[model samples]
Target: MSWTVDEVMTRQVVTVRPATPYKELVALMSRHAIGALPVVDLVDSDGRLVGMVSGTDLLAKERAAAGARRASRARAEQAKAHAETAGELMTSPVVTARAGDALARAARIMHRARVRHLPVVDATGRLVGILSRGDLLKPYLRSDESIRHEVATEVLGRLMDLPPDAVEVSVDEGLVTLRGELETSSAGDVAVRLASAVEGVVGVRNRLGYRLDASDPRMPPLPGARGLPAAEWGR
Candidate 1:
């Protein structure tokens, strides 16, 4: 369940140098069908990432050339229009993700930064690979059969301490339907939440019934109730 950025990232990344020309940058992006390139200092044997230039960054030049009138001129955009080298146009202090970082962490960084691509780096900040939104979703491609087995054995049998056959798990195109009877209502909710957390699960339909309302203050708390919160259980 601990998916790392390197697990799904594109290893053969196309990088650029500080002195790379504008025309070459465009040609590289077009040839590779990529939206961004990590700018590196290639003086050393191992290229060290210094910045990044994206399609939007390249388009800024064109937008400036168009002379689109606005209330205030964006000096940076105007300067980029005349930039001839990667160093002059690239964005510095680039937002990046480490190769060993959790895919969820990388996804969060990408979402918060509003970026489509993430340049994955090594401990020393050397560019190693690239991660995209599409790559982060690779786990969702797991087969329904695999998901069912995990849910029955791992989620229900091991975690819930239920008999393997206690829960009837049905998976169809990543939609999971969990039907079973549990000793406590909270356990039923935990089952639904845990099944939903399984990788490749798009949605969970809780068809489970409970014999006892464990939520009642007079009743004793169910076993494993103190182990994890509902939201953090599957994570």
Candidate 2:
């Protein structure tokens, strides 16, 4: 079974507009206890996501403001320190995820970008929800019995095109063990791969046997076909 971002995302996401004042952003974050907020298009009722303002971003401005009092201001920090609005402080061209996207896809983006939160958008880039690392991990908490059922009925039965009872499936914690006879060695390999893709499956152990020995080498050339020397052939 596969999980999508919408399945675990927070539907009621706190958001802000570009022109929202910096202090207001801080207050909103403090009240909601969220690390970040998606900045939406104020002119449009659709609330399309355009940027993200994070707690770190707010703190950067504070740090820059402090540094300015002690010495000559660096150009970028000077600009940030004087910034008074969310648009001025936010990171534009935001990293975001789609609501229908696979859970793994969203997690990968967050990991690569080193962001804790991701705004879930629609096809038109409208904000629909928000996803956090914690939301992505909710599926792993599913009961092992649920995972085993999907592997047995969905992976082995429907996906592998084998009899429902052909393979004996056992689950311990989150590991899946597959043991049975398959038509070919490749079939067993396919089963293991499919089982691994199922949500909440930590690992897969393939104990399946195959009817065909695909690994066996072909027969060697016959003695006469070796094309030996004339004397050896005569002997």
The reply for model 2, stretches above 4 Å from the true place, is: 1-4, 68-76, 103-108, 136-140, 168-170, 177-193, 204-235
Using lDDT as the measure, which candidate wins? 1
Clashing pairs counted in every model: 0, 0
lDDT, each prediction: 0.86, 0.84
| C-alpha lDDT (0 to 100) for residue 136 of candidate 2 | 84
Candidate 1 residue-wise lDDT at 52: 89
- Model 1: per-residue lDDT, tens digit, 61-165? 878889853455487788898998999889988899998899999999999988899999988889999998999888889789988988899899888788877
What alpha-carbon RMSD in Å does predicted model 2 have with respect to the real structure? 9.3
Winning model by TM-score: 1
Worst-scoring 10-residue span by lDDT in model 2: 221-230
What lDDT score goes with residue 16 in model 1?
90
Models, CA RMSD each: 5.5, 9.3
Off by over 4 Å in 1: 1-4, 69-73, 136-142, 161-170, 177-189, 203-235
Model 2 per-residue lDDT tens digits across residues 1-235: 6799999999998889899999899999999999999999969687789999988788879988777332543554567788999889888798999988999999999999889999999889998999998998889877889888999898888866788778999999999999989866666767888889888889999999876566566643223322322344495
